[model samples]
Target: MNPSFAQASPQALVAGDPDQGAVLDAALAPLRAEFGTVDLVVERMDRLGNWAFVIGDMRSPGGGRLDMSGTRFADAAEQGAMSSVYVALLRREGDAAGDASDAATESTAAGAGPAAPAEAAARDQAGLQQEDADPAVAAETPRGRWVVVDFAIGPGDVAWLGWPQEHAAPRALFGF
Candidate 1:
């Protein structure tokens, strides 16, 4: 089953330690690379088996907003001041990934620790819980290093609909 990474508010994100921050940075490297140092605040995170779903807001490094709503894809560089809901599906690093470390170690090395109880919820109440995870997901092949399975940006409703099914991420992302 997947071990959930604690959720944090936009304000709590700036309070983590350097190592923890680095881990997050590493996890988000793909997003940054595609968006060029775009600003993302993780509003929610849920780990289903080895799959993780991240929901957040994205802004430019210059503090301007970027929106990818409606359209399947949009050029971030072309637009400015468009606030958006960012959603990403991430696969956890498994033993097959060649890394012996677990997610917790990555958190520690990145200087990240648990957020304040008042500010962070352990997991999404409406999301699939550990026990409810599909057994097939735990046995899926191609398991390994962390990967950005898929991502969508827009309003929550629209973004959620954009979750891709062809990627390596578990098909049960929405708890199917």
Candidate 2:
């Protein structure tokens, strides 16, 4: 464990570090935009090379809980509030000499909306199957330019093969 991370409270750890804050803010932007203001209670955080996993829950100001539902997460809305997992693959602005920044800019300009059909098809053909492939592995390919792959909210037992690590701390935290 990083001594700093181990010694700090979850909120202090997240609030005190710029990198973690930026990544978490970006990852949860869509959720925030949709749900309005909500509280995030962090359960665990783990760091890999330049990657991070944040596991937590989201609660409304009135203390109502939110849940995930789709082909990717809880599979149905009734499953209730399992924890949410947010993964970020961070790269400092100059690390790739503008490659990552340029891509991030393009995505930002696009409003981070869902890709067009053709673009989605092309991405799949290019081996980035956003729905079926393991996000961790996809982020590791030559396309390390992925800054924040955003968040996943579910229980560890859910068959989130797309993000196999799901709620668990990243494997590297175990020296794997």
Candidate 3:
């Protein structure tokens, strides 16, 4: 753990934080599923919302960066279409950059998360569900876990997490 990161409060760190890559990894895994071998990781963000300032590394075989600041991810999230919109935009980038080999590796399997952040927000079921097998997870999961809050990725958006974030997104990450 970096000393700089440990300087922050534990509660603050537990939230869906993009700066702390490992903690944020769970939230970003779905995006990775779309990337395949391309290392499209979100390195920094002034904020994580509709009008967010995002800076990320895009080593899409060709190697580059995702210099999107005022993109459409926010708008799509408002309509509960963020998932599809984001994936479509990424797919377009993959095709244009000739990253077909990596793109084809993505799977159309189950547990692919919601079609849009809006949908998850509409039915935000985090604290509401109690029958989950893991009592510890069920109790702790709802306190801070969130990625697609309020129909979009706001300050609580993870975009960095891996397994935990993905599973929690459809449930805990929903709504503001």
Candidate 4:
């Protein structure tokens, strides 16, 4: 079985708090508008190493809730693989560049909110080149392990994969 095909938890539509809702709505608006209903599922590790903010469809291709523990992204190989997958998916969706920028912008904006320093830092960290500044890049995925796949049905079957790695860490380098 393709390990990458493992399922992930379903993401709930944001609720409560108009402000938070608006932010989420705005953040996701472009995606919804552009993609016409995406099957996005996000799972992040919390301080306790437990999954948090799981979202989207959870059913796997084989039929079962995706086992998050088994979907490993801690290794560089996994991260690189996921990165390539994400880039491909983005290219297919025609919204890769915009997505990357929005992600970085959102992070920086949340951290500093309209400050030059923050914006500049975000730009640098995002690894965006002059060619990437075009809005069209949003339609193309970054040249990495990012993959995109069409699952054919079930709560936005499209997915963008990413694995966070810091400085090519040893755990990921030697396949620990």
Candidate 5:
């Protein structure tokens, strides 16, 4: 749902091709470097709407169950606003920026805090595998956890690309 305006009706968000000329890569670059283990997806807010997009991250590799939903952006302005928010978040989360993309992606709780014993061990092991990368980058790429860092969109074509948010509802973002 968009935070800036009430949803006029029940509209579903669909996945979009970030590679298909969407102007989000730059805003998302920092997040891409920080959360390297997940695939970040941008989706149209609905099959008919064209004024908004939503951002979500898939912790799964290639594909998996347990659909994840991300935040909503009412327009390109909102997308830019969220990008700044994410950059700050990435920094607060001990941002990393090297070789994290090589790590395996997996689903994790949206509100996960410190790792449990089992999760900690797994993160430690994954960290070890990334010994060749910067210690900070490897150390911060928690195994099975991710967050939305940024988002954007292109001209709406009404095709449900099945971006991450398509599988479920989304969170209101930026209050506009």
Candidate 6:
């Protein structure tokens, strides 16, 4: 785990609206598009009272599954950031979201692309036997856990928390 990452316990965060399902569904659109479909499982609320939802395992047409999990933010800015994180994870891993023709060409030709080398190197460095670089596996690997902690914080209350990174992405993705 990255030392800079931190996350509140699921018990620490709380949801303000139990019926924010529509809001959550909208916020999750990008992820749904990328992962084929998404099922929001409200695992727990946060300390600050924001919904903490999880993206349950999503099955793919290719007979694989993507097991992504993250929280939703009702606030538009927070929602945008969360969506970006999910998209970035997919883009970084070269997973198809139905865009980027280069991905297919790269995948078929020498396995070269933005993420392929790093992924290959990581595998080599870890000395793990190489498994198929299937899109399903890339989607399923929990890049990290995330939470929308600061979304609910007032401007004046921002200082009450540690640095944003302590409660945000990278760390959040790992569910710390």
Tens digit of lDDT per residue, candidate 3, span 62-170? 5653222345444544655433212100000111122222212332132243323333222232222111112111111222322222112322334434312332232
Q: How accurate is candidate 3 locally (lDDT)?
A: 0.28
- lDDT (0 to 1) per candidate: 0.45, 0.41, 0.28, 0.26, 0.29, 0.31
lDDT of 4 by residue, 1-176 (tens): 11111123322324452222322332333334433444334332111011012223333345553323333332433344323111111101113343344564565446533224334333433443211121232322232211111111222223322211211111211112
Root-mean-square deviation per candidate = 13.0, 10.9, 16.0, 15.7, 17.7, 17.2
Top lDDT: which candidate number? 1
User: Clashes in each model (backbone N, CA, C under 3 Å)?
Assistant: 6, 0, 11, 27, 4, 17
Error of 1 at 82 (Å): 6.4
List, residue by residue over 32-59, the lDDT tens digit for candidate 2: 6555575666665544534455555676
Stretches of candidate 3 off by over 4 Å are 1-19, 41-43, 46-54, 61-143, 149-176
lDDT per residue as tens, model 5, 8-99: 44244333532222223333444455444444454332221112233443333565421223423334434442222221111112223433
Q: Candidate 5: misplaced stretches above 4 Å?
A: 1-22, 45-54, 64-175
Worst 10 residues of 3 by lDDT: 87-96
**Candidate 2 vs candidate 5, TM-score winner:** 2
Ten-residue stretch with the least lDDT total in model 1:
126-135
Model 6 scores a C-alpha lDDT of 0.31
lDDT of 1 by residue, 14-113 (tens): 4342223332443466555555567777775555544566667777677666544434346442464234777765544434434432544455457664
TM-score of each: 0.44, 0.45, 0.24, 0.21, 0.22, 0.24
* Model 6 bad stretches (over 4 Å): 1-20, 35-47, 50-55, 60-175
**10 residues in a row with least lDDT, candidate 6:** 86-95
lDDT of 6 by residue, 1-176 (tens): 22331233433323553323323443345555545554433333232112233323223345353333332233543434322222111112221233324534555466543333345334323322222222332221122212122222112222323422332223243244
How well does candidate 4 score on lDDT at residue 33? 40
Runs of candidate 4 exceeding 4 Å displacement: 1-14, 42-115, 118-176
> After aligning candidate 4 to the native by TM-score, how far in Å is the CA of 66 from where it should be?
16
